[model samples]
Target: MDSLLALLKKKSTGQGSFALENIKCDFFISDFDKPLLYTFAPFGEASADTISWGFEFGKNLDVNVIAISLVSNESWYQDPELYELALNLGKLANFSEILGYGGSMGGFGVSVYSNILKIDRLLLLNPFSTLDPNIIPEETRFRWYQRNLEWDSRFNDGAITCSKGVVVYDPLFKLDALQAKRFKDFKLVKLHGVGHQIPMHLNKLGLLKRLVIDFLNNGSDFAWFYKASRNRRFYPGYFAWMQSQENIHLTQRRKATITKCQHSLKKLISSKPGVDSVTGKDIDFIRDLALDNESKDLMKAKMLMEIALKLRPEGEFLKMKVSSYNKRLDGPDL
Candidate 1:
């Protein structure tokens, strides 16, 4: 598995070039003292995950490489431990600096690596806020990997630790759906109308080269480079159009769920007045929702307290939920 993992990791890093097909990972060791820069790629529909425009960018500027491919896509979710495992591999791989590649789900995941996994710099493409299976509905392009439970997000404020970040959004991002932090925290370059696809933005190499040159040579923010790129190659109307599409698709799903909830209530109501009250049946339904997957989402259970209040209105269950939710809201490890 380690060898296979290494091979896959290589394909993602690309052998220090712009070749997208036979992605192989290796460092362009230019004198042992050269500053190291780690890079990662987005694992989309499994087609272009190996492209290393990021690597090409860095190596061309004469920087060493430490790249990995815990890419974000529907597929890698099949085994999340692997994602974590790939994530942890950076420790073993040697590098003085860090680089994160963005594509599809990789967009946001790479950014978070700053804190969770710890890196220096990252170049993110289209990223997502959360890739949990429970969030996205079936029939969507992302639905396939949702089958694997590991897609659940384990991110927080401290997750992204890069000193400098460069993010590129689909000129037309679907939802703006991903949290703004992916953009707010770094220098962003949004490309519109592009799907979770990669290779469309291979020019991403330029961004990488600039980062290496600044950090390795003079020690700069690389901020000016980011702004200059944005001003010159600006794409208009892409973000607005994506926002419109996102609203429509997301709204459709929300409406469907509300309808389903209405129908299910009919059955719950019809079965009333059955089995003995001693069975403690009525109470548990509300209690269980609070408990079900409570570990993953304490805030949700808290919000549902209002619904639980409606389910039983006033009862011991309501109190229990409120207390549980509040306790969690305070902080974990409590």
Candidate 2:
């Protein structure tokens, strides 16, 4: 329990960066003077969680951390006063280095604020370019952000300053890939199999702390990240991605690729049951895949629908699928 965590555990006194309108910033000053790491909160997360994660990652190193939490998905681009206050605090402390780090909504915050804060480096994971549907119509996920688009439209343009940055994301997630591609200046690190939750996956493999520490000491080094991410091959997300690839191969009629993917999926399923559990939607998808494969196995598809219905008895979609399958089975062969 560090002093920052202790303070957060107790209520704030409206003192220095602790209280901001619709935002909360927590500071963890280490015993030794070191580079400052500023982390922004992910969607719907409290500043405490971001601070705790930063403390855990930089605990061994001589690093001071400031974690910012946003009350909503506003992106903080509209708030110039908050940025000014952050800049003043950093100058007051005379920190040796300032780095910004975040993921998802937090990533958006870091991208927008780091420039104003004059951050030396940035480490972002699966960040969104903009929630404005007008700018990015494909970005339909965060509706809350879309509803409250009060900031300057130019703010949603892209990364401004902090030329040196490491953006990590999976190309499989189409929207995240799009966002990562929009960053003209940042160095992209593609972690293929892992979805948007790159930090969680890295943390699970016991490599997140090391990666962050290395990045803090050194700048954006892709080689280190590549070596650290080798363990991702064994992660559940990798297996899930492999299953998706298998579906693609099946659709393409690529027999060799399908066989390889099937073998890999079976092995993964055997080792990781939780990852292999078939849901109603998964079964429906498999049913469609079976039909697309041009297989005359209508009975098998019906059985699958039955299994899906059993899994989710109240699922109207599953019921409709089962009824459709039954109709096809009972209808005259044509």
lDDT digits (tens) for residues 1-334 of candidate 1: 3543353345333233221122333345453345556555555323334533355555655666544443334434233463455465554444454445555555544555554445666555555545453543322554545454454445422223545665555543444335334355666555444334423432321233343344455443644544434421222222223335443443666556544654454444333334333123654665677677377555445544534554454567677767766654432110
lDDT of 2 at 133: 71
Q: Candidates' lDDT values, in order? A: 0.46, 0.61
lDDT of 2 by residue, 1-334 (tens): 1234344334222123455566666666653246777777677665432342343344345567676776544555455545666566544544567788888877887777676666888888888766767667887686775777763554565455544778888876777888888777777888766667677766654456655766787655567567646645434556565456422323445445545665664543343222456544565575465455325444445554555455456769768877876654432110
Residue 2 in candidate 1 has what lDDT?
Answer: 51
Error of 2 at 321 (Å): 49
Among the numbered candidates, top lDDT falls to 2
Q: What's the TM-score of each model vs. the native?
A: 0.45, 0.64
In every candidate, how many clashes are there?
17, 0
